[model samples]
Each structure stands twice: as structure tokens, then as C-alpha cells.
Target: MTTTSGFLLDQVMVTRGETRLLDTITAHLPGGHCTAVVGPSGAGKSTLLRLLNRLDDPSSGRILLDGIPITELDVLDLRRRVGLVAQQPVLLTDRVAEDLRVGRSELGDHGIRELLQRVGLPVEFVQRRTSELSGGEAQRVCLARALAVEPEVLLLDEPTSALDGVSSGVIVEAARDHVAAGGTVVLVSHDLAVVRGIADTVLVLDHGHLIAHGHPDEIDYLEAGR
Candidate 1:
């Protein structure tokens, strides 16, 4: 493993088309801590996470990971360390197992089985078709796929948004366990209940600008909603 880690956003700006999404913002996401970004629709919460992982280039300023500027690193290498999971989970392979092994060439059935169990998938899922999985099952598989590489920073864009209570709980539990085992998790969620239980630190953003930065309980979310 290379000595590559840590993320710092210094006066960063984000834009899509002519719309200025995120204004110049500076923030530090400590390594190995789970930071829940809470905000309503149109807030730049997701955009912030996207900028950190270099999924989208910033309009201005700089993003540094482990003291190295993001622009200077190889695109593929940068994404490998900063894993991103979207709201609508996408499985890239025909089979569930193939999805997990996409970035990890060294992973085998045994390794896949272990990850499956960790994410609450049955062993039967290894040989099952990706299309056959349920909504929650697919999300778990996506989480498993992300964890297979053991990324330093995990970007989850409401990974549980589409699942039922049982599935949501499973995914959340797995994520908590992953961070407990020493992975940095950055999540964006409008669900205050979910953020309250999991977020060690919470940052609230509004209209592409960070409005409140603190624990969810400390700040009245109702006040932030206005």
C-alpha cells in the first residue's frame, strides 16, 4: 500500500453547467472518522463528497488528500482510494460476484463469501444473477463491492435511501462496523434520525454553502430546515 491518505478541502468551489453549486468552502474530514453531511434537496452536500473523491473537478481552489493535491494524482488511483456509492445503486456486472471482483483481481470466492457475510448476503448470492437481487440486497452487494478494495475514504450518497427498514438497518449496521474497523466514512442524508444515531460529527449545508457545522443534536435541525 502506498503512503497515500487524508483529505483537505481549501477554498474549494463546485459548478455544474452555468449553475454554481458549491461556493468556495474549506473543511477538513479527519481520517477514520464518520462525518455525516446533512442537508435538504439542492444543498451541495452530495457535491462536497463528489469533490473530495475527484468524481467532479472543482471550479476553483484545491482538494488535497494526505497532503497531496487531488489534481496531481492519477485519476484511477484517486478513485481507488475514494470509493463512491450513489443513491440509486448500480451493479456493473452480470453476476453478483463479478461486481465485487471488478477492482480487486486478487479476490476469490472465499474472499467474496466473507464480504457477502459481512454485508448480510447469503452464500447463494455468489452464483446468483445481479438482476435477481432485491433492492436492499443490491445495496448490500454494492457496499460489499466498495469494501472489497478497502478504500481509505468511503463516499456514500444515501446508500440506504432506497431500502426498506430491514435493508436500511443492515446497510447502516455494516457501514458502522466498517468505520469501527478503521475506515473513513462520509455520508449525505436528509434523514435526521439516521444521522443522529451514526454521525460522530455533522455538517449542515444549504444552497451549496455550509450553513451549520456541529453535532446534529446540538443544532435544532428544524432551525436548519428553515
Candidate 2:
């Protein structure tokens, strides 16, 4: 399979209502690796990820994938190739089985089983209603749903922010494995510990601009001495 990867932004800016939420920024996410975006609250980390998935377009400048501009792609096709998983999982009116069975019809059953196993869910979850899922269960289901679309790039915005330690661990491992399998992952989180566990590179954002960018070990040492 062809490994999926993309560039990020070139002096992009974002605004909401009357307030400037994100300032001009430029950063390149290395292909085929997990890049962890970390910072304090209101640091514009989540906004950056949303821009990558086109959930919210930039007010100025542009986000590019490869060398092509993002706005040039078809919205539906773009979303299919780029999956977004938020901190609080949202489920549609469908069973867990039907959710994961969305992308391909032939392997629906097998796909659901495999996804559940990958996300640390038991086979029993297949029949469960989306409404009845617990916090951890819901997040895993959301992940499975994202993967069902066969997306090449996954954008996670605090995906484990609402889960317990055990639950977070499962999702972290799932993210790591996906990257290892040639998929690109961009994760936005404030949890340094979580970043240390899975991130290959780290991007520190503050006030909507690129503050620091380097390997996780570099930041780990910097944080240790502070």
C-alpha cells in the first residue's frame, strides 16, 4: 500500500466571530510519522488540526497536501481521505457493526470484528447501540468509524482527553499501530506524558503560531530541566 502523507500550512490564519483565534503560522508535518501538537489551553492546537481536515478553513493563506492546495480538492473526497476524531466521540444512529461496516460492503462483518479487536473492544460490542456505549467504548467506536472510511490521514484532536488511563492507553496504541502501518497521524493534545509515549516529532504551538518543533526526546529533555 502507498503510504499517505501531507504538508501542513504556510502562514495560515484563522478567526472566529470577531476574535482572531489563530495567527499566521507555518509548519511542515513529516510524512509517515506521528506528529504530536502540544501546548497550553487556547494555544490553537486544535484549530491547526481542524484546518488540516478542512473542518474549518483558514481566513488567510492556505493548507497544502503534498504540493497541491487543500481548497482545490473536492470537500467530500477530501474528508474521506482525511479522518477527524475529536475528544468527545460522536456516534450516528447506527449499531457498532453497521458503523464499521460503512466503507466496504464485502468485508463488513470481518472489518467490524477486526476494528473492535484493534481498539480493545470485545466482539460483544458489535450489537450494542451507539447510545449505550460508555465513554471509552464510544471513543473506540469513533476510531473504528474513522478507519472504516479507509482514510490515509487521521487527525486526532484530544482523542483521549475524556477517557481514563486504561482507555487512553488503548487509543494511543491504536494510533501508534496505524502509523506503523503506513498511515499518517496528526495528534493534538496537552498531555506531555501521552506525547512522550507515541509522538515521533513534537510541534509546540502558542497563541496560534509555531513556537518550537523537534523530536520528542528534545522536548523531553527541555521539560525535564525546567
lDDT by candidate, in order shown: 0.82, 0.82
Question: What residue pairs clash in candidate 2, if any at all?
Answer: none
The sequence of per-residue lDDT tens digits that candidate 1 reaches over residues 1-226 is: 1334457778888877888898887777766777888777888888888887777888999988887898999989888988988777899999988999999978999999999988878888999999998877887888899899988878888887877777677777877886888888888887666677777777777788877776656767634454
Displacement of residue 60 (Cα, Å) in model 2 is 0.6
lDDT of 2 at 88: 80
Estimate the TM-score for candidate 2.
0.91
Candidate 1 residue 90 C-alpha distance from true site, Å: 1.5
Output the worst ten-in-a-row residue range by lDDT, candidate 2. 1-10
Q: Give lDDT for model 2.
A: 0.82
Q: Candidate 2's error at 46, in angstroms?
A: 1.2
> Candidate 1: where are CA atoms >4 Å away?
1-5, 222-226
lDDT of 1 at 30: 67
